[model samples]
Target: MSVDPEIHWPIPPKGGWTADDLDRLPNLPPHTELIDGSLVFLSPQTLFHSRAVSFFEWQLYHQAPEDLEVIREFTIDIDRRNRPEPDVIVVGETGCPDLNETRLPAASVLLAIEVVSEDSVERDREVKPAKYARAGIPHFWRVENDNGRAVIYVFEREPATGSYTSTGIFHDRLKVTRPFPIDLDLTQITAKRRVE
Candidate 1:
């Protein structure tokens, strides 16, 4: 949650934010994402959100296949107007881009995950999923906090319409085979007060 407060933002160009614009911006704090040509500065994560992300970060990293990598807060270039920074991404090692690069192409991505914050409800539920689906990302996962309990909703892409269909909904535990075999006890994820 240690984000820089100083950022000199410019008036968004008549054209929405594109990959070229992202390259031109002066280095601002991390977690800046471009959506529809506008700079979407993410709020510093809250404890609830942070714990969930950290839990998954470890889970995904250890359980992922040797050929795939699990990363967090990385941007995916969805298209001309959308580059979303997903909370957790599982991408193929060979398809992965340089780690120093800010954006990864959708083709390299196997999964896109968003852990919803109160501020991100509408965007997570609607905007991002639409963009990822349009970009043909094969899988998407949304983690929701309901009364301090985490509920994971899984989606798989529908090739015909570039949309996602609800594949599973998990609460107590997550056991899935797509995007790699993963078996996580969700109770341990949200119940912990500290990450370590």
Candidate 2:
């Protein structure tokens, strides 16, 4: 009798995941926040997405009041399980830190920006806003690159419900006229593309 030695079943990895488990994963791909004990994979941002971020960053870097410091793509740890990397963050002078750390304390973040990618739209629009609001981070901005245009969503107040209720959307032609102390020209700001 000949045995079918070629037939075999692969065993899956064992056990649940924790934050420590996440730390063990390979550093090649970027990871994101999940509920209590899971890992979420972050999709890479597209060229358009990168452009929008750069444009906004340039404007804020030069135009924001000298007292406010702007940081890019830094993780803000809201809890043991929720750490989000906003595209651009405005932190008060006292709260800003040296460049050695990977995470920022929630209290230090004054404004958080998330540039929407196709793969992350739902997570950006729904999951993260709720998380930020719960953390009592005062301001949150969502930059959506959809249909060859950019739209900005500014949440003024912390959301009482699961998502931001008080919001403003600025299109390409309109100026971002609110969020005092930082005057931004939305049209000119979003027009600059990232150089290759």
Candidate 3:
């Protein structure tokens, strides 16, 4: 018989846990998010989730212009009550937070990407995109695993209507020109590592 370690969940302050509370809260699970003033704990990541996030992060960091930066698993300050962390974010250099910062203002985010996990399908597919568009983020990508292959659903915000318009869906490769030109081989996401 084995004993599991104890986990402590913080009590929310007066109204509820604010975006700022995430940084101050003690013993909260790693990758804890705030959605509508409530705590949203993430389930353990799967190999596909981790690989897909790494694939995009690496590709974006190498291809993005000097004015933009790629970040992984960092929260965006959507509102006082919602600070959701996207799997990968491309942010303009001017809006990049300092070394000590834990989150970025959604206004500065050029693109937000979420790699779907079994537990986060609804939030990633629906809720987060709506909020990201409302916050004026220019682009969003939701990556889903279809029978062990990655399918990328790309969306760009319509400036006139302030809603996301489906740009394109990439199955084997992702090539997009808006925000910046990026072309990546989706198969690289699961390639075996070479021992050098």
lDDT of each: 0.86, 0.70, 0.92
Number of the candidate with higher lDDT, 1 or 3: 3
Q: List the residue pairs that clash in candidate 3.
A: none
TM-score top scorer? 3
Report, for all candidates in order, the number of backbone clashes.
2, 0, 0
> Mind sharing the TM-score for model 3?
0.93
What lDDT tens digits, residue by residue, belong to model 2 across residues 29-105?
56455444456667777877877788767778886778888888777777767677788888877666676666677
Candidate 3 ranges with C-alpha deviation above 4 Å: 1-7
Candidates sorted by TM-score, best first: 3, 1, 2
lDDT of candidate 3 at residue 104, scale 0 to 100: 92
How well does candidate 1 match the true structure in TM-score terms? 0.90
**Per-residue lDDT of model 3, residues 1-196, tens digit only:** 7555685557777888899899888778889999989999999999999999999999999999998999999999999999999999999987774888889999999999999999999999999999999999999999999988999999999999999999999999998898899999998887778999
- Cα deviation of 191 in candidate 2 (Å)? 3.7
Candidate 1, number of clashes: 2
Candidate 2: global Cα-lDDT?
0.70
In model 3, the number of clashes is 0
Q: Regarding TM-score, does 2 or 3 come out ahead?
A: 3
